[model samples]
Target: MSYREERRADQVAERAQDREDMRLKLEAQLEAKKIAAEEKRKDSEAKAEQTRRDAEAKRRQEQADKRARQQEKERNKAARRAKYGKVTGWLNRNPVTAFVGFVMVCSIVPAVISQVGALADAGVFVLLAALLSAMLEGTAWALTFMGKKAEDEGRPAGKYRVATWVTAFLAAAVNYWHWSEALPNQTWVAVVFAASSLIAIYLWDMKTHGSHGKTTEERREEKARKQHLADRRKHHKDIAAEADRLLSALPFGSIDEEEAFATAWRIKMGAEPGLSAEVYANATNARVALGAAFELGEHVRPELVRAGMLATLYNPLPNRLSEGIPTLGPTLPIPALQRSSGAATALAGIGMYGSEAASGNARENASEKDGGSTGGNASGNSPRGRSDEELEALLPKALKVAAELVAEGNQISAAALAKRVGIRRDDARRLRDRVIAERKLKLVDGDDTELAG
Candidate 1:
């Protein structure tokens, strides 16, 4: 009973195993089919994306080409406009010249031919009369052309211009006679004929003379340029000749006219253009004189005073007292000093003490007696304290003198004030400070404490 039951159980287990294997095989086949379908879908999506990208790139390239074509068209249009603008500008500027030329060619040729042909009808040789008319008008036009050419070249064109007018007048007279003879009752026709011949020539002449609708500013500039050129030629004839020589020596187009003139002026004048040795000397002298006037009181200021230069004034005596200008002697009294102070100072000590030394010494002795010692005062007062008191006494007078110097544009220093008012340098410095504080004046360069004595 156990063997039979075991064998049946084993067969049942085998059948169940076969069914499980079949189920797994079916699941694997379904999974493979799903994977293939997913791969095909991904490939289709990739192809679609590629097509879209290609379409976008092609559209962008076409748009870029369109923009390039449009830019090129606009550039071509602008270039055409510029080309037309230049031509129109030239035509606008020369309207009168163009009009006159057109009128002369259309009217003058026919009128002159007919007028001379009238002479042929009066038994003159036809060919000879035509040739004579052609010669008259041709000669006038030729002279006009030559005159304009000469004027443009900056040459003398007056004679050619006059010849052109004379020839035109002769032609007018011939036409006048012909018209007057042909239309005896209509004498105005003779005048009209005469005017027709002269009008074109006159307008052409005016155009060449720069009166063809030029503005007032243009005319003024032209006149000024002519005057300047004339003045240069008149003042610098030698340089002008040298310039001409140099211009002729060099290649025709190598050097500009003004450049040649400048070179020639440097070579011939031995100085800068528009300047001479005498003029330079005069200017230098004038400048030195002005500087010297500014330095009149500066000699007393050792720091501000320049070395190796002295200022002097040439004061003349009154006309009532002297016959001519009075010269300064070595020991003569200075008028500038006399005006500012009542005393006469020697020129030798004018920069230093004037007449203040004796007063300075007496005050020093008095300060020594009152200060009670030979040494400097203990209150930071140099020398004696009484000297400061004496300086305070003289401060009013020193201030008056300082004010006068300031009015004359002189930069006041302690030394200059001390010399003027017979005071010590320290007292003078105190007086200067009082003046500055009271008057609100700026501190000048020469009054440095570093340079104070």
Candidate 2:
């Protein structure tokens, strides 16, 4: 019993020792894992902080670059504005001579630089040549600048000119000496160079400060051109003013008057090929007279005269009277005779006040004639007797007469039309109404008294 019990107790103690060793090993591994995790988190945070600093630095660099670019742009803009102002101000304040001198200096400077190539190089010889060229050119430039300043200030530029000439001579002499070595016969070369230089200087001076000595014919032509431009400007202004006045005087709903004013303005401005200044002047005068008559509430003979003047202006040909002015529509049978007769009748009836009843009768007769009453057939046909061809042929003439009368602000009275055309009063009125209807002519101010195109 003693041996068995002791063995069992030993086994239990050994088991307990083994479990304690295992627990110690597991605790060591857990502590090592926790330390590694803490180190990993610290590394990640450091990396994020580094990336943020780099981004901040890069953004600062970009801002610096943007500021630099803006500064450069402002500097360039200021430089250009200053240079432009200087050049333009000088040009504006000086005469053409200043421009000529400037051009000469520009040309001569480039030529001198090219000829004296060593002056532009990078050596002792270059230094010497550059100094020499600079001295000469600088002196010339200074003189030129002074001359221009003096001219602007209304002071004598004689001293400036003398100094410029002296500098130019020195430059020319130096160039001549430099070129003489390359050329044969140095004496002749020098003489030729000196002569050429003198001639060039003389020519430059003449071109800058002397007259062109234009011929009488040239002077006259230039004068004429200026006068022509002035006249054209005046004509344009006058036409525009008149058009504005006409437009203002017209009623708001008077589209026809507006169109007429526009047409008249165009014609006056030489919209048509054959129109002349004289014709335009006459037409403008006529229009002004017509406007005055309208303003005065006297609208008959003045309107007719204006129409005639406008027609003449519209077709301003030397042979217009003889060949008959070309019209928009078909030709009339006896246009000259009709115009003369109508004009005479208009003049005679200027102050004659006809009764309203008579005017009403005339209008009614025209209406009845238009409805196809055959009363006054000169062609020996019924009222509707004329063929389509005859009617077409007569229509243009009748329209012309009616247009003239309407343009004159006159009513198409059957009696007046009959007297003018030598047709029956009823027939004349019927023809007038039919022409008006077919042409779609509108009555002026909703009144049967006046018609407008």
lDDT of each: 0.62, 0.56
TM-score of every candidate: 0.38, 0.29
Candidate 1: which pairs clash? Answer: none
Off by over 4 Å in 2: 1-14, 17-145, 152-154, 158-190, 196-200, 203-207, 210-222, 225-453
Backbone clashes in model 2, listed as residue pairs = 374-383
lDDT of 1 by residue, 1-453 (tens): 699899999989998998998899999999999999999999999999999999999999999999999999999999999999987887899888788788877768766776686668778898888888888888988999998888779899899988998998988888788888989999998888887778778777776675747798999999998998789889889998899999999999899878988998889766767766776566544433432333233224332332212223333433321121122112212333333231111111212212223233333333344333322223344564235566667666765675565554344445556556655556655765555343322212212221121
What TM-score would candidate 1 get against the native? 0.38
